[model samples]
Target: MVTTPRITPDLSTNVGALRLAFPTLMASGCYGSGEEYAPFVDLARIGGVVLKSVTRFPRLGNDAPRLVPVASGLLNAIGLQNPGIDAYLERDVAKFAERPCAVVGSVAGFSVDDYGYVTERLAARDEIDAIELNISCPNVAHEGETFACDAALAERATRAARQATTKPLIVKLSPNVTDITEIARAVEAAGGDALAVVNTVRGMAIDVERRAPMLGNVTGGLSGAAMRPIALLAVWEVAAAVRLPIVGQGGIETARDALEFLLAGASAVSIGTANFTDPRAPVAICDGLSTYLNEHGYAALRDLVGAANPTFLGTR
Candidate 1:
């Protein structure tokens, strides 16, 4: 008797207009420009890279002790460090043209107009496949995460960035808000193409010996395995509240963690703090996801998306 061959499961998924070959993206800030991890992993095998957030002007970032390793996670107050939009456009964007995977530019700003200016400048580049409006960065001072916390502010910022560029606009929301779903709805109404749920949870650490806060900024954004549960719930809620695709993040470190987000309703999972522990985690996740799909008799990654959520309202 002849046996039939089993076909490999498809890992492809769509984030707005960007069709990712894989449903795993190297989260912004942690992965840099994808150049840092080029030596350790094959870029083409993963989905894409959300480049570090660029602002309208240069920032010195937080002082020393910006990172503190806490129980099951990390506390970071990097302050959205970048060379600013003008310098970034002049020296950085050209390098992304050769990246094997899609390049999504991240823009962070203090005000609505700032989001528009930086987003327009970055998305104008042919090298950038999409734009991630980082309205939820907790590390920065002067209400950086304010846009994501307030529904009206989120709408204004998304609208401003939407008017700036025709590229796919992904609004990154904050988990520190009172109601993340409300903000998600506002963003969708403001023309956002997708949503990156749960940036980082606001937290802090103290050193008794030094009699001071562990992080220079006093408060920091917490990420890693610790924030996984919070991020997952945010993704589930946002997925039910809006029809836009969701890129779930926070403290994902392994295939199981990524799988949890997908089941919760994220179309894709962004790897962040996990890279610090293991650079090969992204590739491993892709392999593990394929195995899980095949073992469960699923045909593609999209099949697993929102599998556990009854009220999921995404496009898939």
Candidate 2:
């Protein structure tokens, strides 16, 4: 069921099928150890591997200057800590379970039975294929961004994390919204198969010579490259109000900024603070999207996903 990223830019396929390898992934708590940046690159040629939020217990996060720097990006609140959920199924489930790609597992909490006890304890493990329901933990201190800005508490925490698994859940939306399409149609009417639009944008910085606030938990979560145009205008307004499938991430670093969230509809993409400034930035964004599709003859990579929405329903 997992065929070598299905020939060029598979970025690993299967969202409902769940495989995946080429849509170029990585955003969950920003690569703490996708093989520790694999000594500078080669995370299975991009399209899978999203760990770092594991929790149902261990977490010692938040402290230090925690992180803060602006004028284009950088402000974190490192609170989802980690190392919980039975030591993340014991030290990152067998080192990303015999790697190759596709590992997604980013959970986090604050109710709904702690997101169904960490989604039935990481879906009883198979080395997780998908379950990224962080629900945007904006530096905790009161259960991340108000249960991700309402939407009926984001559809009761995405239907208690979709009755705690069968894999593939992905609901991470929370750009401190006012209406992120009412929390991405309330996690696609409480079943959520995909929607990782954004998860960092609450900001704050003021170290005016030690004059207070600059992280250390005073409010953070800015992300890089000045959050590329508000994360591509919220992945082009939630990929024209959801039909599902979107993995875009804020301030992507290249491959033409991951083809501008796949021409504003995003079926896949996430680089996050250029992996701390380009540890081979996703193999230079997969060789700059295969040289921008061999100089535009355009072929694979889902043939340019969304293909640039045309005004997406005039002035909404």
Using lDDT as the measure, which candidate wins? 1
Give the per-residue lDDT of model 2 (tens digit) for 1-316: 8543322333344555566657777888788748888777777787776788776788898887888768777899988788788867866677777767788888878776788788788877886778888866432544454777888877887898899786788888877788898888878899888888787888888878989987887987898889788878987898788677788888888888888887777777777777887778887888788767756666566667767776442121
Cα lDDT tens digits, model 1, 1-316, are 9854566999999998989999988898999999989999999999999999999999999998999999999999999999999999999899999988989999999888899999999999999999999997432444445888889888998999999999999999999988899999999999999999879899999999999999999999999999999999999999899999999998888788899999999999899999999999999999999888877888898988999999999867
TM-score of each model, paired residue for residue: 0.96, 0.33
Q: Give the 10-residue window scoring lowest on summed lDDT in candidate 1.
A: 136-145
Model 1 clashing residue pairs (backbone): 224-251
RMSD of 1: 2.0
Report the number of clashing residue pairs per model.
Answer: 1, 9
The regions of model 2 sitting more than 4 angstroms off are 1-21, 30-46, 53-57, 63-69, 77-80, 87-101, 105-124, 127-206, 217-223, 226-255, 259-270, 273-291, 298-316
Relative to the true structure, candidate 2 reaches a TM of 0.33
- TM-score (C-alpha) between model 1 and the true structure: 0.96
